[model samples]
Target: MKIEYADRMRTVGEMGAWEPWLEFFVEGIRTQAAEAVAQTNDL
Candidate 1:
């Protein structure tokens, strides 16, 4: 079971398999941008 699970775990260089990673990065950028905008508007 352990080896099978390890085989399923994906690396970033794989095409299409990196979608989740990209989504995470985009979400992080969006969250930071929103926080910055809110801070500026409050001032």
Candidate 2:
């Protein structure tokens, strides 16, 4: 069972129409993404 990153990203894009769900999802994504980027950048 293997899925490509593009497919997963497209699935996430399809979910954007649901605002309530998108809020929580985006919140978590921002926090995690910031942490990941900060770790890499030594910020």
Candidate 3:
């Protein structure tokens, strides 16, 4: 998602696209939480 974030950050100053950027950030958090849960379950 580093590439995705880089692409979004570039256009974030253009205006009206903040919603997608926020969604991307939230999705990243959700993804990390899921991975952490799975790792804990494995132990």
- Runs off by more than 4 Å, candidate 3: none
lDDT (0 to 1) per candidate: 0.65, 0.64, 0.89
| Candidate 3: C-alpha lDDT | 0.89
Which candidate would rank higher by TM-score, 2 or 3?
A: 3
lDDT sort, best first: 3, 1, 2
Best by TM-score: 3
Write one digit per residue (lDDT tens) for candidate 2, span 1-43.
Answer: 1244345456678864455445656777899999999899995
Per candidate, the number of residue pairs that clash is: 0, 0, 0
lDDT of 3 by residue, 1-43 (tens): 7899988877787765888898999999999999999999999
The local lDDT score (0 to 100) that residue 3 gets in candidate 3 is 94
Clashes of 3: 0
Q: Listing every candidate in turn, what is its Cα RMSD in Å to the true structure after a full C-alpha superposition? A: 7.7, 6.2, 1.2
Question: Could you give candidate 1's per-residue lDDT for residues 17-38 as a string of tens digits?
Answer: 5666666667768999999999
Top candidate (lDDT):
3
Higher-scoring candidate on lDDT, 1 or 3 = 3
The runs of at least 3 residues in candidate 2 whose Cα sits more than 4 Å from the true structure, single-residue gaps closed, are: 1-17
